[model samples]
Target chain A: MSKVMVVTSGKGGVGKTTSCASLGAALAQAGRNVVVVDFDVGLRNLDLVMGAERRVVFDLVNVVQGDAKLPQALIRDKRIDTLSLLPASQTRDKDALTEEGVGRVIDELREKFDWIVCDSPAGIDKGATLAMRFADLAVVVANPEVSSVRDSDRIIGLLDSKTRRAESGEAMEKHLLLTRLDAARAARGEMMKVEDVLEVLAIPLLGTVAESPDVLTASNLGCPITLHSPTSPAARAYTAAARKLLGETVTVTPAREKRGFMSLLFGKKAVLQ
Target chain B: MSILNFFSRNRSAPVARERLQLLLAHERTLAGKSDLVALLQREVLGVIARHIAIDPDKVIVKLDETGHVSTLEIDIEVPEGALARG
Candidate 1:
C-alpha cells in the first residue's frame, strides 16, 4: 500500500528536512518509488538539500495554483531512478497552499509513488497542520533537549486531534526520530539520554542520528547522507530507520561514544583526561 | 568522570526529563480537556436520550483536575414531570 508520511518537528533546526531527505532517499534506494515533498513553502530548502535547486523550474505552488501539472513540478533525482522531489516555492507564502489543493496533489502523487514524504515546517502553524493532514504516519523529529521534547509533546497532541485519521477515529501511527544526538555529551550527563527522551515522548523510537560532520558535509554537497557517505554512522542510522518503517524488526541501539586509539591503548583513564 | 562533574549542578539529562514530564502532563490535560468533555457530553446525551426525552442543552459535562486526580462531573437537569412520564 502507498503510505503518506510526514517528517515533522514542532521546534525548528532539529533536522526535519535532513530526515525527510535521508529517509526518502533510503526508501527509494530500497526499490520503492518515493517522492519527498517540501511543504515549507516560502522558506524552501529541500531542493538544495537534494541537489536539485537548479532544476526547479516548476514548484508546488505552481502546481497547486493550476499554473503547472504535478509531473512538471516533480524533479527526479539524478542518481536514484526511483527517487523524486516536489520542491516548494520560494516566492509564494504559506497561504498559497489550500487544503483542497494539497489533497488533490497528494492523491495524484499517491497513484504514482509508493511513499510520499512531506517535509513539514517547524511550529504548530497552518503549514505544519496541512502537511500532516493527509499523512498515514508521522516521524516526529526531536533533539535531546528540553524545548524540543516539549514542542514534540505539543505536536503529538496536535497529531491526535487534528489529522484526518484522528477525526475519522482511526489511530494515526507515529514514530519518534531523535536526531543530532551527541553520544559523548549524553554519556557525560550533559545531554539527555536516549532512554530519557523515550520516557517523556512515550512513542516507539524509529532511529537516532549521532552528531557528525558527515551530515553537514553531505548537506553542503547537496546530497543525501546515505549516498554521500554510505558507511557513515548517520547514513546507517537513516537506512535502519527506513527499514524499520518498512515493518522490519531491526534492533536500534543508541549511538555509543567512539573510543579513540589512544584511549584504547592507555585505558579509560587516559580518555577521561 | 571529570572533576568538573562535582562542580557542576544537577545532571541536565534527568532535569530535562523531569521538566518535560511535568510540562507534558500539564499540557496534555489542558489541551485534551475541552474536546474530551464535549465529546463525553454528546455521547452521554445520546445514551440518556435513548431512554428518556431530556433537554440536551441542560446537560453539563466537565473535567476538573485537582492535583493528580481528575473528576468527570456530569449534571443533567431533567424537566419537572419528565421523569413521571417515563
Candidate 2:
C-alpha cells in the first residue's frame, strides 16, 4: 500500500527540506518509488536541495491549477531513477494553494508512487496544513533546542487535530527526526539530549542526524547526503531512519563526536585505545 | 561571577527543557481558546468587581489541566475591609 509522509517543523530552518530530500533518496535507493512534493509555495527550496532547480519547467501550482499535469510537473532525479521531485512555485503565494486542488493532486499521487514525501513549509499556515492534509505519517523535524522543540510541540498539536486522518478520528502516526545534534555539546549540557526531546514531544524517534560539515557539502553539491556521501555520519543516520520507517527494527546510534587532536592525545578514553 | 553561578549557568539544557514544558502546558490548555479565555477573564472580573472591591490588574483567570482533567482557576485579590464597604 502507498503511504504519504509529511516532513514538517513549525519552526523554520530545522532541516525539513534536508530531511525530505535525504529520506526520499534513501527510500528510492532501497528500491521504493518515491516522489517528494515541495509545499513551500513562494519560498520553494526543495528543488535546489534535490539539484533539479534548473529542470523545473512546471511546478506544483501548475498541476494544482490544472495548467499542467502531474507527470509534466514531476522532475525525475537524474541520479536516482526511482526518485522524483514536484517542486513548488516561487512566483505564487500560499493563497494560490487551494485545499481542494491540493487534495486532488495528492490523491492522484497516491496511485502512482509507493511513498509520497511532502516537504511542508514552516509555520502553521495554509501551506503547512495542506501539506499534511493527506498524510498517513508525519516526520516532525526539530533541532535539540528550546525553540525548535517548543515549535515542534505546536506542530504535533496541529498534526493530531487538523489533518484529514485526525479529523476522521484516525490516529496520525508521528515520528520525531532530531537533526543537527552535536553529541559533545549535548553531553556538555549545552543542547537537549535525545531523551529529553523525546520526553517533551512524546513521539517515537525516527533518527538523529549529527551536526556535521558533510550535510553542507551534500547541500552544496545539490545531492542527497545518502547518495553524495553514503559513509558520512549524517547519511548513515538518514539511511537508518529510512529503514525504520519501512518497519525494520534498526538500532539507532548517536552521531559520533569528532575527536580533536588534543582530545585524542589527552582524553581518558583515548589512553585505553 | 561566583563559582556557584558559573556552575549553574553551565547546565542550560535543563533550564530550556523546564521552560518549554511550562510553556507548552500553558499553550496547550489555551489552544484555540485564547480569545475566549480573555473574554472570560474580563467578564468574570466584572462580575466579581460588582460585589467586591478588587484590583483588576491583580486578578488572574486561567485554565489549568492535570492529565485529562481541566480546571478553570480564578485568583482575585481584594483589599482588607473591602467586604464591609460593599
Task: Point out the worst 10-residue segment of candidate 1 chain A by lDDT.
Answer: A264-273
Return the clash pairs for model 1, or none.
none
Residue range B1-86, candidate 2, lDDT tens digits: 34454356466888888998888888887676777778988998899888987888878888777788988888888899998876
Fnat, model by model in order, equals: 0.78, 0.73
DockQ leader: 2
| lDDT by residue for model 1 (A44-105), tens | 99999999999999999999899999999999999999999999999989999999999999
For all predicted structures, in order, the TM-scores are 0.83, 0.84
Give lDDT: candidate 2, residue A61.
96
Off by over 4 Å in 2: A260-273, B1-9, B35-86
Could you give candidate 2's fraction of true interface contacts? 0.73
User: In terms of docking quality, how is candidate 1 classified?
Assistant: acceptable
First chain TM-score, candidate 2: 0.95
